[model samples]
Each structure stands twice: as structure tokens, then as C-alpha cells.
Target: MDQYKLFLQRMGLIGTSTFLVTITGIMLLPILTQNLSIQDYGVWTQFQITITIIPAIAILGLPYTMVRFLSASKSRTEIQEAFYSILFTVIFASIMGAVALYILVVPISHVLFNGNVGVGLILPLTVIMSALQLVFVDYFRASNQMTKYAVFTTLQAYMVVIFALLLVLMGRGVVGAVTGILITQTLISLIMFTFVLKQIGFKIPRFHNLRQYLTFGLPTIPSNASFWVLDASDRYIIGIVLGITSVSYYSAGYTISSLLTILTSPIYTVLLPILSQFYAERKIRETRFLLNYAIKLYLIVAVPAVIGLSILARPLLYILSTPTLANQGYLITPILATGGLFFGLYCIITQIIVMERKTKITGNIWAISAILNIILDVTFGYFLGIIGIAIITLLLYLTAFLITVYYSLNYIRCDFYVKFAKKTIYAAFFMALSLILLNPYGPVNIVLSGLFSFALYIFVLWLLKGIKTDEIKFFTGMIKESLVNVYCALRGL
Candidate 1:
């Protein structure tokens, strides 16, 4: 029971922080679209995709090892050694990555932007800052410092919004936006590094079990890179095949679809450390229960959310971006939203692999999926335009989830509640029906209709007894606890 309460508290903090990030991202869509031309936005989108993959490659997969190893450590000295080892390793890699970025800037720019190499000058700095930021943020998460993690993440999001918007408004275009990211990450990285140093102190990393860390973390580079291929390669394909303007349209729809992750991501953040701890302690029953509950909770929210996004994709695109984006890219949301749902499920299921120390299996799974995703994305894009690439994403995740689930079951058993899922599906169908009957126009109507649809879904679920009383009590407790925490913080202020 205490464990459950702690989980909820952690969830509330991380969830609130993730929610803030989603809001900032949503806000940035219109600001960026209005400020930069579609072509420029496409270039920015391409740059964003590069950053996602490059830093993962640069870090040599050590951050994930932090989550695995650091979470399991007992002694403060052991924790410090593991933390600083990963930190020093990532720092070295960041310097190497910056140098590589500088050396390859012209070629990369030519490939991604058709020889528009002006952004190359700052790409190295962005890459370095991003790599360090990734390590710092992951360290906090591994240490179970949820409040510090939330504060740093939320600060970075707000800073990016404020600075990026100002730069764009001042006519810096894509360069301004990239600069905003660079500056914000640099500042936040310094702050987080200081915090981590204070916590871990300035001892040599001792290089204890360094080979174990490498053996565990190294294989994940391909896995992470492949997952990136699954997630972001489509934009590159779109940019290459259809041109930058289409990339912007596709990116707008992709961003809207990513809203689904806001629901799952925070839970994912909390789940990793908890699962790691539970597994390490041989608490198999507890681990199984948490896994089942997470799956159910994700479906209960994700099913309706996916349906609703599909229903309101166009209106959302229109309100959040230009009419051009709405008209050209609205269809991309339903596909990607559904894909996002599968991806979230995969995250939950794949924890079995992580818990079992079958990290290499993860690498193999994503490597296979990545190859298939690239093949499908490229072939589909050639034949079917932007929608083809979008469909590829959904298909890729569905495939990955099935494969991961099949392999994961070998390590640990997880339940899937068919009757409960059927109930959720029925309720979601009715929610979609309600929204269709209303067929809301404009942002205000759409927002209201969504709320009505959600309330109706819950009411239907209650009527069907799909939602248990204990679950209600759990959520109520979470709300009450969060409120008390907020009040105390205000009093402190």
C-alpha cells in the first residue's frame, strides 16, 4: 500500500512535468509555423530529427545503464562510482561527437538540406549540449529524484518556448530556433550537472564494473538508433522524396500525434525505476501486478484518446497550425496516434526484457524492426506519398509490439484482461459516436466536445462496472496528496 502511494506521488510529479512539456510543444507549433516559412520549418524539423538520433549515438548508451545499474546500487560509494563513470564517459563522447559534427557538417547539411549548410556552424554546439543534457536528466531519474527531475525538465521547456519564440519573432528563423535550443540546454545542463555533482560529490569514478556497464549499454545503441529509425526516419524520407514543404506538413501531424505519449510517458518514467527495484529484490508478484495495472491504465486512456484524436485531427491541425498543414497533414494524426498507442504498449511489455537483463534481445528486436521499418517506409513513401510513410509507422510499431510481447513472455508472464479491454473498447466507441453526433467546429467547440465525450466514456464505464471502486479511491488519493504537496510548497514560498 505504501508502495502504491509512492508510485502515485512519483507519477503525479513526472506526469505534471510531462504535461507542461506537451503544452509547451503544442504552443510552439503555431509560433514556429507562423514565424518560419514552411520550408524553413521543414528544415528545423529535419534538424530536430538529427538531434534525437545523434545524441543517443554519441552517449554510447551509458545513460540507460545508469537507470539499470544505479537504480540497483546500495552503497553511496557504489552509486557515485557508477554515476561518475557514466558521466565521464558521456562527457568524453560529447566532445568526440562535437568534433565529428564539425567535421561532417557540410556533408550532413548537404544530405539533409540540399546544400543549405548555414545551420552547420551551430550544429556541433547543439549536439554537445544535447548529449550532456541527456545524461544529466537520466541521472536524476535513476536517482529517484522526481522533484528535481521535474523542475529541470519544466524549466528547459519554458526556456525553449520563451527564448525560441523571441528569437523567431526577432527574425532569426530556423537559426534562431536552434540557437534557442542550444542556449536553453547549455544553461540547464550546467545547473543539473551542479546538482548531480553536489549529490554524488567529486570523487573519481573508480571504473568499477565498467565492462559490465559497457556490455549492457553498448548493444542498446543499435536498439535506440533503430527505434529512432522507426520513429523519425519517415520525416527524412518525406523530406527527401516529397520535399521540405511536405516535411513540414507531415511534421505538424506527427507532433499532434505525439500528444498520445504525454499520457504514457510520465508513467513510463516512473515504471522503469520501480520495475528495476522490484525485479532486483525478487518481488516477482509485485512486479507482475504493477505491469498489469500499467497496461490496463494505459489502454483505458489511450484507446479513447486515439479515437478522439482521429476524430478531431483536422480541427486540431487547423487550430494548432496553418490551414495548409491542416489540409495536407490532418490524416497523418490518426495513423500516428494509433502508432503511438502501440509504442506505449511496447514500452510496458519490453520492460520484461530490461528486467531480465536481456538487453541484447532488445537490440536484436529493434534492429530487425528498424530494418523492416526503413524498407517499408522508403518503399511506401515512393509509392504512396506522405500517407504511406505514416502508415508504415503504425505497421512498424504493431509488428514491434507483437515481437516484443512474444519474446517478453518467455522471461515473465503478464496478463491481458480481454473482458476489461472489451468494455473499454465499447466505451470508446460510444465516445467516438458522441463526438461524431456533435461534430464540433472550431477549437472551443472541439475542446468542449472532447470533455463531454470523456465524461460520457467514464459514465458508461461506471454503468458497466468496468472501473472498480478501489481504482477510484486510488486516483482520489493521488489527487489529494498532490493538492497537499502543492499547498505545502506554496506555504514554503
Candidate 2:
């Protein structure tokens, strides 16, 4: 169908961006790891984790409203109105957040940082830029401008990498690193963000649609707050309890491992607006199909990816990280990958929940999940060093997937847990079995072991007939279409 083609096109664009980002990361990280000191890098990472705390306040749940509201708008005029309202909201919040940061800089600085007050000045700018960027991003996504959205995200990433490298080589140190992020975001907001926003038609925020936006947004503030709380509380608490060095190790480990999330995150970004619209139109079959298919694709890729990362974590740490990070990275990689898989599943399920306007339900799930994260992260961080913390975070995410699936099953089909296990488990098991058979002894052997494992996994999938009958049909159809298209190109069809 045309729709399926469109989805593939969107997926390709987004996938390209993801790949570019991964490559950029592969290039940028070694330089950063080699250049920066562990404590300074840790402090730098604290800044990174700390910023997630702001959107909870500054965007103030506007993202959730923007996705749901702007996606459902039918008329161009109505969508325009929503964009203006959101723009005004972004600007207003930016100013307020900046001012609040100015006010709270001293007291909270002492409390959180124990007198290292410079992070205070950095907070306001980062929060403002983040606020503007979130609104800009959400607006574009809600408008279904996938190609431009994809380009913007890609360029923004490249810009960050370039700037960070420039800053570091200039000897600006940690401040330079943070400056790179601030500069990239601000430039995007000024250049691409505001312009494309105007193309969709700009107006000042008006009273008419304003109430609906706020009505939709306000209740979820605490729910979103819970996410911020859960994310930052661990870092902040660790910084406080385990010392800044602990924060640094944890931060570095998390930063390196979180590239997996960054790569996969955009797929969810592409799916949400489209999914919301499908749900709004009551296209139940298509919606259910995507939901199931996404889950299947995630399991297929994520399982092997997780195992492979766990297998490679020790060497990956040695190659890509500093002494502090290398030590922590080996332990963190698998745990983070496992958690990342769960989070990916949660995103698909949560999109279903969001589409159904069951945000309150989703919120409660996040809240309980956040609490679990806190208890486990704190307990683990305290008793077992950071590995314990890592495991706890992974467990919480898996738990959330379970909770979300339990709640959102009515909105989807193809019991994914069943489909996933039957399709992939035996295949994956055979892959692991291949590693035992080969019995490679060194890093080259280990690398070969992973390669053989993947080959066996694919082979078993072929043998079991579990690659989804639809996938074969789709591939064959694609080949046929390609030949026809080539003929048409020759004949000017």
C-alpha cells in the first residue's frame, strides 16, 4: 500500500540520521575520552543528566499535549493556531525558567554542589535552549514533517560533535563541552526552528485554543515530573552520597552506554505522531498491526544487540573509555542495553496508551516505575557499587514494559511476548550455542564468536520459519516493484 511505502520512506530517512549519529559518536567519543579528566568529565556528565530535570518544568508537559493535540487537528488553520500557542508557551517558559535559575543559583548551588556555584550560571542557558528545542521538535513532529525533522535532528547532532571537538581542541575544557551543547541548541532554535515554524503559519498565542492546550497539558506535569525526578535523583543523590567522582564514573558509563538509546530513540519519534493520528481516526487494524510489528522488530534486533553488547562490553570499554570509565563501562554496557530494550518496548506501548488518552494510566505506571528505579538504584548504588545501580535501572525498565503491556493489550493484537519468544528465543539460543561450539580463545576469536552467533541466529530463524511470513512477502514484493520501477525509468513511465 501507499501508506506502507510512506512508512518505509520515513523509516529510511530516520534510519539514516540514526546511522550518521552513531558514526559521529564513534568518532567524537575517543577524542573526548582521551582528552578529558575523569572528575571533570564526571562533572560534565552531571550537567548532562541534570538538564533532563528542566523540561519537566520548562516545557512543563507541553510535549505530551503538542503531540496529541497538533496531530489531531484537521484544518491547516487549526494546526497553525496550535503551533502559535505552543511557540508562545515555549518563549514564555524560557524566560521564566531563566529568571528562576538566576534566583535559585546561590541557594540550590550550595545545597546541590556544596559551593561549586558555576553550574548555576550554566543551568539557565541550558534550560532555556532545551525548552526552545523541545517545543520546536514537538511542533515539527506533530506536523508530520518527517524529512525536514530528520534533517534537522541530523544536522543538530553533527553541529554538536563539531563544536564539542572545536571547544576541546581549543582547550576550553569542561566548560567548552557544555558550551558546545548550548551553542548548537540555540543556533537550531534561531535558524531552522523558528523558520520552519513560520512556514506552518505563525500567530501569537490566542485564547481560543489556549485553554485546550493547557487543559491537556497541566495534569501530566507531575507525571512528567516523576520522569525527571527518577532520572536526576539517582545522579544527584549519588553525587551527594558517593562523591562527585562517583557521579563522574556513573555519568561516563551511562553516557557511553546511552548511545544505544540515542540511536533507537528516533524511531519512536517518527512513530508517535503517525500513531496518534491513526488512533484518532480509529484505524484500529492498522494501529494494532504497527503496534505488534514494532514490538516484533524491537525484540528481533534488541535481543541480539543486548547480548552482543554484553559480550563486547569489556573490550568496548578498553577501546573507547578512560581508566575510570573503562572500569565502569564493562559493567554498565549490558545493564544499560537490557534497560534500553525495555525502554524501547515501553515507548511503543506508551504510544499506544497515549493514543488511547490513557496518559493518567501511563503516568501511574511511570510513577510506580520511577519509584522502583529509586529504590533499586539507591539500594544497589549503596551496597554493590555502580553495577548494582546499573542492574536496578534495567530491572525497572523491564518491569515498566510488563506493566504497560498489561494495561495496553486491549489496544493491540499479536500477543507480542508469545510471538517474540516463539520466533526469536530458540534462534537466539542456537546463536549462543554456536559460541560454545566454536570455542574461540582471544579477542579475534571473541569477535568471530559474535559473528558466528549472529549467523546461527539468522540460520535458525530461517529453519524455524519464524522471520514472519509477511517479511518474506514484503521483501519479494519489494524486489518485484524495484524491477518494475527500473523498467518504468527506462521507458519514462
Candidate 3:
């Protein structure tokens, strides 16, 4: 198959998986919030933040390195050496990371976990399993094994939800939920390892290209850490300055707004490997086309999503969480959703930078942004509460996006789709207007209004000729092809 078709199919697979994973995550929100005390819920949120940051550091950015370096690899031996080297290195780093985390548990417990020692104790185990899981998942991603990638990704998410829900329901509270996650991560990591071993067999990894891998990957550690700072440090600041209860509120709203990021997930997952391969083959035209097309596709959905999410934030949060959480946190959705939009754009634009192998530039941009974010997070969070932190988040994301665009263009110029975006904005504005006029309330009404608003947005965009006929046909064809592939796979099973 052509790369475009394969990209679409892989995208469809990953997109569907991401949507299911997101839905399951959202389903857990009410379960956790209602079952645990507000303080415990805050601790649960903090646990999540800690796990995310730890794995980003512990994995040492090698997953990204694997994707960049191994995406174009055709030699089984070469793949084996690179994969095992990275995996072994990640294991060592994760062990050291866990030990560090264990040593610092007291401070972390006080600062982030609201002084919950039990949760702090369990974190190192979770981080180690999570770090290993990261390497396993990325191996499939780098190999373009999207079916395996999507299945395992979806399975891991569902398993976490299932285990956490069961444990939380069994009256285990925060620690139980954390334990459940660790169990899921361990199981998934082992299962993935088995599959990888069966495919590539084991090798003692000569570390032939280890230095080159680390060279590309290590810079990303700072970038990934900085991203976590941008993406999550506000929770820490909120927990510290405002209190754990306020962290719960901020996290709740942030979670709802983060649904906007699901639109970017498949693109982020699929684009990198494909672009890496294309660029490696020196297919510059295809590379540029993919990048430009990705941004356009992202904005088409993302623009309307930002507007729709912002408009429906209150009702969505109310339905998903408690009234108190909804009322206190709903305002955060618009700001964060807007930030998510910019962040999504930044993700797409940075592919060019990645293609050019200027990861240090990307790292530097985020490093500066993260520092500014931390400073602003403290200042605004201390003075103005979670709302101030949310505003700062939006500004920093916008700054990152602008800087990335400016730098990325020096490598390869991309169409920003200005006119197309203007049309999408118009459609989204009308969608927002329709929702406002309808004034959707309650679960059933919100569901209905959301559907109507989306349809209206499409209709308006269609009338504006923003969606061309060929584009519609192209998507229709992609969907039909995806369904046929699913049907064939099911029959084979």
C-alpha cells in the first residue's frame, strides 16, 4: 500500500484505540471522585502526575530515540541490538530512578501526595513498571506495528481502569488505586516483553549504536521533563499554595479539558515514525506534505473541538464529576482547551524540527517555556489560584507554539492553513452560538445538543466550501477501507 493509505489506516486504528482509552479514563473520573474523599482524590491525582513525570525521566527519552533511529531499520539484527541496548539501559535507569524516588518519598509525600506515606511508598514500583512499559510500547511504534501498538495500548488502559475500579470499589481508596495501576503496568509490560522476545529473540546487545541513540535521546529527557513541567507542574503548585482540595478541583477541570488532546494522540503516535521513515528515504515532498496535511487535519477537528469543549465544559464536568467540582473547575476547561489547541499545533509543527534532527532546539524551546511556566505558575497560582495558573498555561503553550513555528520554518516551510483555519473558526463560532441558544442542560440534553452542534458545524463548514468534495470522498474511502480491514481481521480470527 502507499504510505498515505497506510498512514490513514494506522491513524484510524490508533485513533479508535485512543478514543476508547480516553472514554474509559473519563468513566473512571466519577468513580474515583465519588468513592474517595476530596483529599484522597487529590492524592490520586498527584500519584498520576508523579508517575507521568517519573517515567518520562526514567525511560531516558529512549522511546523517542527508538522511534527516530529504528523506524527505518530493515535489518533484524540491527533492530535487535538497538532495541535490547535501549531496553537494558532503560531498566538500569528505571532502577536508579525508583531508588531515588524511594529516597525522596518523604518530601514528595508531603508536597504532592498531601503527606500520604502509603501512596508515596508504592510510587517507585509503579514508576519502574511504567518506565519498562514505555520502552515496550515504543518498540511496536517504531516498528510500525500499529495493530499491536493499538491493541496493547487499549488493553493497558482498560486493564488499569478495571483494576483500579475494582480495588477502589473494594474500599481500598487511593493506595489501592495506585496498587491496581502498578499491577496493570507490570502485567502489560511482561506480556509485551514476551511478544517482543518471541519476535526478535533475545540478545545481549553489543551496544554498538548506544552512544548515538543516547545522543539523540538524552536531549529529549530535558525536553520531556520540561513538557511535564508545562503540562503538570501547575498541579504541584496548586497542591502546595492552594491545598490538595484545590488540586483536586484543578485536576478535575484539567482532565476534562485534556479530552481535547485525544484528537492529537493518533497523529502524534503515527506521524513521527512515518515522517522519520520518509525523511530517512529523502522523500522530502512526501515528508512536507504529510506535515502540512497533518496540521490541516488536526485544526479542522481541533478548532471546532476547542470551541465545543469550552462551551460544554460546565455541563460535561457536572455530569462527569460532582457539582462542587463542576462549579469550581468548569472555567478551567476553556483556558486549558485553548492551551491544548496550541499545544497540539506545537506537536504537529515540531515534526519538521524532528525531521531535521534538531532536537536540541526543540528541547531548548521547551526548557525556556517550562522555566517561565514554573515562575508564572508560582506567581499566578499563589496570587490568583488555579484560574491564574490556567491562564498562564495557555500563554506558555501559545509561546511554545509560536517559537516552534518560527524555528521549524527554517528547516521546511509548511502551510499554516490560515484560510482553512478561518473557515473552521467560523463554523466553530456558529456551533458555539447554536449551543448557547439551545442552552443544553442535564446529561440527555447535553448529549443531544452536542450532536446537533457538531452536525451544524459540519453543515456550515460544508456550505463555506471549507470541506471539499474530494476531501470528503477521501475520508469516506479511508473509513470504508478501515472497516473492510477490520472485517477481514475478525474473519481471520
- Which candidate's lDDT is highest? 3
Q: How close is candidate 3 to the true structure, as a TM-score?
A: 0.97
Local distance difference test, candidate 2: 0.69
TM-score of 1: 0.96
Any runs in candidate 2 off by more than 4 Å, and if so which?
22-26, 107-116, 219-232, 410-414, 417-419, 430-453, 468-493
Put down candidate 2 lDDT per residue, 260-338, tens digits, no spaces. 6543665577777777777878898887777776677667666776666665666555666665566765677767777
The predicted structure with the larger lDDT, 1 or 3, is: 3
**Candidate closer to the true structure by TM-score (higher is better), 2 or 3:** 3
Q: What TM-score, computed on C-alpha atoms, does each candidate reach?
A: 0.96, 0.87, 0.97
**lDDT accuracy of residue 358 in candidate 3:** 86
Cα RMSDs, all models? 1.8, 4.8, 1.7
Model 1 clash number:
0
Error of 2 at 328 (Å): 2.6
Worst ten-residue run, lDDT, model 3? 484-493
Off by over 4 Å in 1: 483-493
lDDT of each: 0.84, 0.69, 0.87
Specify the poorest-scoring 10-residue window by lDDT in model 1. 484-493
By descending TM-score, how would the candidates be arranged?
3, 1, 2
Candidate 3 local accuracy as lDDT? 0.87
- Model 2: weakest 10-residue lDDT segment is 484-493
Model 3 agreement with the true structure over 1-493: per-residue lDDT tens digits: 3888788888877777777788876888899989999999999988988899888988878999999988999999999999999999999999999999899999878887888899999999998999999999999999998878878887888888999999999988899999999999999999999999899999999998888888788778766675567767888888888889999899888887888867888888999999998898898899989988888889888988888888888888888899999999888889999999998888888888877878898788877887888888889889888999999989988988899899988988999989999999999989999999998889899989988998899889989998987877888787677656544543542
